[model samples]
Every structure is written in C-alpha cells, then in structure tokens.
Target: MESLPHQYSVSVNAEKENELETTAPHLPTLLVAPPSQFDGPGDKWSPEELLLAAVANCYVLSFRTVAGIAKLDWLHIECTTDGVLNKVERNMLFTDIVTKVTLIVAEESLRPKAEKLLKKAEQVCLVSNSLLSTKHLEIEVVVGG
Candidate 1:
C-alpha cells in the first residue's frame, strides 16, 4: 500500500455574538458576520478576500516549507493572486484564480528546481487544491536572482 503523506486538520468554532473562532491547523481567523463596515465590528478581512489571501499565503509558505525541507537556499520571494468572479453558463457563479509566484535564487541553475518546488507546493497547498477542483485555477512560476 502507498504510505500516507504528511497530513493535518483545522477546526473552527463559533462563539457568542455572531463571532466565529478557528482553531487547530487553521492559520487565520474567522471574523464575525455583519462584516465591519457593513454592520458590526470584525477583522478587516472579508470571506472572499480571506480565501484568496489564504491560497496565496499558503502557496508561498508551502514553497518555503518544501525548500527548507529540501535544504535549498533562497533569497527573495513574492506571490500574487487574482480571483475573477464571473457568470458560468446562465446565472451560475464561478471564479478563476490565478497565482504568480516569483522566486529570486542565488544562482541561475536553480530556476528549474524553483519551479519544481513551486509546482509541488501548489499540488500540496490545501487551500489551492480546494479551490482548484471547485473552479478554474492557474499558476505561473517565475525565477530570478
């Protein structure tokens, strides 16, 4: 049988006054509804923005994680994500998320490996994978330095 890869779980709990709390492997918070400017006070992040930020942040973090695991030295890193919401078919809601990962390495030969690492990171990124199967997702990796 194939062995299991590294795994973890995140949990979210709701508390008083329409507030939500996230726990376990969760890297971010779940703000209460009404949404700051819309009504009540909460974090400045919206649910949609939260999703994008999570995916983008997770991709970059995953890359660094793998790079460290692979014992590769790196320099600068930047990740950008754009989510486009459009109508699918008639009224169906859809989203297309595109991510650009730019990595600055110490040597030119590391470009290929950098791309490989970024790809692997994408495959394993929990948020990215979740969104990929749900909607159209594309990623581009550019290496420099």
Candidate 2:
C-alpha cells in the first residue's frame, strides 16, 4: 500500500526594492526580504531567517505531536535555530543549521522520555528532512523550570 502525497504552495508579491509580501490562504501575510547585511530592509523577515525558522518550527511542532503520543508532558517548549551561511566558491548559501530545543517538564523522571521524543521529532521534521544542509540538534530538558 502507498500513501497519498500532499502539496503546499504560497504566493509572493514583490513590493518594491527587496521587499515582498508572501501569502497563502488561511495564513497571515508575511513581509520578506534579504537580510539587512545584504542591502534589504532590517525590519522585515529575511530569507535566511525564514529558512532557519522553518526548520525550528517543524521540529517543535513535530515534537508536540510525538510527545503527546509518547505520554511526555512538558511545561513549555522553546526552540531557537541559527543558520550559517558562507561563500562557497562564488555563491553564498546556508551551510548548516543549528536548532536548540529547551523543554521544561514537571518531573525529572520524564527527562529520558522527553529526550527520546526530541530525537524522534528531529527525525520526523518535514522541513529539516527536505533541507540539503547539515542540521545539528541541541536538546535541553529541565525539570520544573
């Protein structure tokens, strides 16, 4: 038996001078651009940042579902991602992405299970799975914090 494939799409409208508005049905419009270091607006979301964000967001959301199914309860989940870009030959591209996930749980005994769920989440994150760059995961599980 085979599973059905799913497709997603978004539209980007150019809004003059390195700024664009990205939109999809049922989602809020996003202002996007290159980073200020690349002569784009500082206040808008950069393509690099958005790429990292996609990775981080995928992991956390995946974790939520995995943790729930695994009976791992947490007080909070915070994920931060950093992307490293370098000039490779002549073009600049992301070389690596590091995602740090901090989970706050009420009981110390749940740490091991939470850690496992984090690993599973990374394995299942669609965005990270689709990226060609290297991804590093840092997991921090805190008890009652």
Candidate 3:
C-alpha cells in the first residue's frame, strides 16, 4: 500500500548559518534548532533533543489537524513532551517519549469533543509510531481556567 500524501522535505545545514528549506510552499521556514545547551562540539541539535522535539511537535500538529477534522473549536493549546534516554542493547540511545497536551476550548461543552480530537491526533502521529514502545500521552481539556 502507498501513503496518501507524499513529497515532503526538511533541510538543515550546519554550515548554512542555521538555514533550512521546506518543500511545503505554505511553510515559512523549514525549522531551526540552537544546537545543544552544552557547546563543545556537534554543530547541530543532539539526536536525543531532536527526538524529543519531533514527538512533541508532531503531536501538536496532529492535534490541530484532528481538531479541525473533528470540528473542535479551541481558543488555546499548549503541550509538553519528555523522552527517556537510556542504553538499550549494547549502544546508548533513546527509549521512549511521553507527550502531555493541554487544550483550552471556547466552551465547557467542547471538552469531550476536544478529547476525541486528541485521540485522533495520536493515531496520525508518525513520530509516535516510529518509536519502539508505547509513548505515554497525557491530555488535559480545560474550559476556562
């Protein structure tokens, strides 16, 4: 079977002054990362940090898409993600990512609908599926406060 949508690119250049390009004409910048907090070597973002962000960002995008598909109207949305890095097998690498999504809807009645959107978001989350084990997702729907 073939994927429905195809053709996408994210270009990153260490020597290009943190410049990038995206095939999606609608997208402005490809994406930017300030490298690691520890500045010693490696001119690019660390693999672990990239993994964490990828999972995080992918879910957020997925959530938004799902919300629109499910007819969910929201005022604000915030999310946080965590990846547990450890040594698996003989080499050291990432283990899993846990994403927490906080959704604020326009009205209290939309909370349940928002929750359903989150579920669909998880389903289309490509980053989550790339991982090996289950990635724990914590979703919260807040009405006003």
What TM-score do all the candidates reach, one by one? Answer: 0.63, 0.92, 0.72
Per residue, candidate 3 scores C-alpha lDDT tens digits across 47-122 of 5566788888899898888877777889888889887667778975567667888888868899888888887898
TM-score of 1: 0.63
Model 1 accuracy (lDDT, Cα): 0.69
Model 2 clashing residue pairs (backbone): none
lDDT to native, each model: 0.69, 0.89, 0.74
Sequence-dependent TM-score of model 3? 0.72
Instruction: Give candidates' CA RMSD values in order.
Output: 4.9, 2.3, 4.5
Model 1 regions more than 4 Å off: 1-43, 89-94, 132-145
Better of 1 and 2 by TM-score: 2
Comparing 1 and 3 by lDDT, which wins?
Answer: 3
Write the residue-wise lDDT of candidate 1 on 106-130 in tens digits: 8777777877887888877878887
- Candidate 2 local lDDT, 36-115, one digit each (tens): 88877778888888888889888999998899888887899999999889988998888888999999999989999999
Q: Give the top-scoring candidate (lDDT).
A: 2
Best by TM-score: 2
Clash pairs for candidate 3: none
